[model samples]
Target: MTEGRVALITGASSGIGEATALELARRGFTVYGAARRVDRMARLTAHGVHVFEMDVTDDASMTSGVERILHEQGRIDVLVNNAGYGSYGALEDVPLEEARRQFEVNVFGLARLTQLVLPTMRAQGSGRVINVSSIGGKFYEPLGAWYHATKFAVEGLSDSLRLELRPFGIHVVVIEPGTIRTEWGGIAADSAVARSGGTAYARQAKRLAEVYELADRPSVGASPRVVALAIAKAATEARPRIRYAVPFGAKALLALRWLLTDRAFDWAIMRAYGPR
Candidate 1:
């Protein structure tokens, strides 16, 4: 039944995106993996996943990538909007331009790609839009104002889209992942240190960076495959839920925040990310 179904996954060069591409391909969908690093996805080719050089922040790249898929497959049954990065820094020290770029890739880029694919999905009367959000969407942490903001935007956007598309049989699902072992942590740590390293927040910022860097350790986070499996389930389930938060502990963390008072949450964050 899933033989001819087509899926387009962004940020497919590595991590959850890469894992999802392989998992979906294994399940018999014709998967097209898109990312900025075309060469990094070459390994995906062996798994029968088509690779496209797509920069989600660029309109031209996004448009052409969609066109190529539609031209070849005639329809897209699933779209995983997964291209995003963490711009970790204190709100005061992070540049507005950098913040905009984060939103460009994480929020605006996901929204625009959804817009591009909705028409095709509507024509077919069935499709799934999977936005790769994060647990940060529901909670806050130190040195992650901009990144969390983008994810919060994704959560709201996906919620609204799910309702709007229900009538058309198009389901919008948000996949919220907790700590996952990937280069994402290293990139975020580097950004955190770069923007706030020499400022007054240097000590606190560096401490948070160490926390982020811990993600590289296998024991610190879930494997990318864990999230990938959740994504596959969301895309293929007959009655899929609107949101899937990966790694069972992620939901618990969200619940903890929900139950905690503002001051308590602040204290917890400080204890976790503040200077040791």
Candidate 2:
């Protein structure tokens, strides 16, 4: 049934979103890559991927994007909620407005878009919702409070949605990626320093920023293609797992999180990014 299925991927301008769009399109799906950065996706069209501007934080853009897909394709088989960012800063240092923006981009926009697509999916009697979470969803880090909160919310929301959609033949799957080579790390590192440096958390924020930069390096982070492959598998599988933690390390990291006592894990995270 996934053959020739229509797929819409958010945040397709760069990184994993872009990679997923390419992978899905290469697999013969009618792929629509959506992002506010319309120009960046111009090359995707060469591969037969439809490109459009979509600001996930905006309601009109999301609604109209879904409408366009339904109008053009008559059905939306896969929805990839991949548009998100890491807003890193000490909880006390990050402005409430920024925190709210994080949730708006990472959680509420995803929820609303799913709401818009469910009616069509129900009519078709089949669909897939693939949410791009992170290993951060399963663990903690310094200066990542707002970002982690949004990802944690995604984890919980996707889990509950999977149960609710099963009867309707709609499979909801979560993809938790480990550190991936992307602009995200640089952006997050900058945010951490900008928001927390010179404050009481400056020392820890600097260390967190270093970690982000280190992980962003191609040598350290896995390629976004790895996550894209995992997503394609989830989208096409007859019975995808509840979650796909990519590149092996993500699953092992999540397992360790569950295995260790919270306090012990906290110590570990501190030793890695915060003070011992």
TM-score of each: 0.98, 0.98
Which candidate achieves the best lDDT against the true structure?
1
Over the stretch 48-157, how does candidate 1's per-residue lDDT look in tens digits?
Answer: 99998999889999999999999998999999999999989889999999999999999999999999999999999999999999999999988899999999999999
Estimate every model's Cα lDDT from 0 to 1: 0.93, 0.92
* Tens-place lDDT digits, model 2, residues 11-77: 9999999999999988889999999999898778888999999999999999999999999999999
Q: Which run of 10 residues does model 1 get worst, by summed lDDT?
A: 212-221
How far out, in Å, is residue 177 in model 1? Answer: 0.3
Specify the highest-TM-score model's number. Answer: 1
Query: Which segments of candidate 2 are over 4 A away from where they belong?
Result: none
